[model samples]
Target: DCEFLGIVGRNGSGKSTLLKLLSKIYTPTKGDIEIDGSLVPFIELGVGFNPELTGRENVYLNGAMLGFSNQEMDAMYDDIVKFAELPEFMDQKLKNYSSGMQVRLAFSIAIRARGDILILDEVLAVGDAAFQKKCNDYFASLHGKQTVILVTHSMENVMAYCDRAILIEKGKIIEEGEPAKITEAYLKLFNLNS
Candidate 1:
């Protein structure tokens, strides 16, 4: 079923590992995963970007990696640029763009990819406060309408956006339940009273 699920844990607690496993970037050593439909993983920003290539070229390149054709990328190009708010910089080489600019572009492209499931890792922490709010709004629009598996450290995000959540520790799921309860449990581990 389509749902918003949050995964939370301390650093190096396998939250990202799980997302990578789901995204097929890392094959589990001893497990199987069954996904029912298409998935898009916004795991690492600027993953397929070429430092030598212009942002416009990188857009098509990244789109191709996401299984989009040139024609399809052409259709989404304008929207992607608009969302990134980098219309004037699309012709600039990726190496010349700031980290934030690159992240904005990559994130813009990732959200454009249609998928049954979307796996995001730390994307909410990208950009400045205003951009983060935009990300928040985008997730708000997807709540209950699309399947999203988000890995984040923000309890507020878990409570605000996730209906269900899981807490991971040392590479295993230690708890799973309603977002509020799961977040409370997670805080308890850190001696924090939520």
Candidate 2:
């Protein structure tokens, strides 16, 4: 959201909350968070999803949250499972699904719903190595076309995906710059690399 928007910091640095605030999932205590366009927050897809509901049902529900209608979701149904690679279990209740499956479905839905601003948490890590690579590839394909904010503890991944990183400490920004330098500072400041 700034000149250098990647965020890195120690535990409890309000990084998640910051994304929550920007996505309107959490209200700031003092100031109103402002963004000029449509915003979508990619949270854990299983958090509020009904486990008893089939993957098909969950797709529409998650789509609604992302501002898509049933017809829209229907159009994207095949794409979602293809991206998630769980086409075989599309009719099963999500409760019968594994955590990875749930995450896959959730992420698939999130990825399909277009937005002007996209905020991604660490939820993508729930997938296996192969799926993570797929997600990364999809993210790269969207590079510079849509405004994307990625939140993660993996400095290497952040460095690879983002051009700039911002360091936050205890709810306030402490530093901001190119991904390499800012991540280095964050690791040293937090003793993360040691």
Candidate 3:
């Protein structure tokens, strides 16, 4: 079991597409995918969110979409709000929140959900530097305990967090091995060196 696998590739090189396929957001044109356990995907910002709804309401809505009960959401509510650092703004409509705030709330909710495997796409692109460090710490904490499939372009992130990695190009995996090695090959694709 690959506990933490990072995917790295250039833009439009099918990295996000691969994550989408794994998350069931898109069906593969051909071939099949077999997943052995429950998964949580944080593919896009505000995916299951309604802009007109209050942040508190959206939390419950998102939890429900993830197969969580109201009681479960209630139990996690405080933690989510605290993590997002937006407890005061929970009553406000999501549309009124800044993009950063919206992403923070969405990410907080997503991370709270239980899952055997977590699929993330460009999650590191969210929040400010301080919040990004929080995200880094959170991922660091999950190092050996959780199964994560991450899509990112940052070689530093790949080297820092991943146990294994793959380089995809044109919808096919061209390299797979240690994070450092995969990242090296990814760099060469763009005439850059690690």
Candidate 4:
């Protein structure tokens, strides 16, 4: 049941659209899409964050949206802050936080939230290198333990984390196979298109 799948393609090639469909943020206009488990989507980080609210407050607010009760959020609150490396900034208003700070907090919540599947869109591109390494290590650990659907342009990421991958072009499946082959084909698309 655990599978790490990557969707790779050029910009505007429906990679994000596919994630939306999977997360039910967009219903497919055509075929039936079925998902067997609950999904926690990190499609647009900081989407629901409020500028006026303190980070601590927003954490609780966002946790509620994910269907976590106060007790549950309380249990996870420390880990979330710890992971985001924002322990000192939690009481500060979100508007005062830098863009990097905001994204780290959002990413932390997405990873820590309980769900059967994780839907991510360019999430690894965020933060500084150290944080990115943390993220990479986290995904590596989840390799055979979690079902993750990642939409990314980083061929390195596809090669490193994906068990399987699909290359999308112009809103269609161009290829589906091993991560290495799909990434190689994805790179070739640039030469062919140009």
Go through the candidates in order and give each one's C-alpha lDDT: 0.91, 0.80, 0.90, 0.91
> Model 4 shows how many backbone clashes?
0
Model 2 CA lDDT for position 182? 87
lDDT of 2 by residue, 31-144 (tens): 777788887677555556898899988988888877888888889999998999998898999999998888888888888867787788875476899998998888877776
Off by over 4 Å in 2: 1-4, 192-194
lDDT of 1 by residue, 73-108 (tens): 999999999989999999999999999999999999
Q: Tens digit of lDDT per residue, candidate 3, span 63-141? A: 9987899999999999999989998999999999999999999999989878899888989878999889999899999
What local lDDT does model 3 show for residue 59? 97
Clashing pairs for predicted structure model 2, backbone only: 6-166
Which is the winner by lDDT between candidate 2 and candidate 4? 4
C-alpha lDDT (0 to 100) for residue 134 of candidate 4: 90
Candidate 4: tens digits of C-alpha lDDT, residues 119-175:
989998889999999998988999889999999999899998999999998999989
Clash counts per candidate, in order, are 0, 1, 0, 0
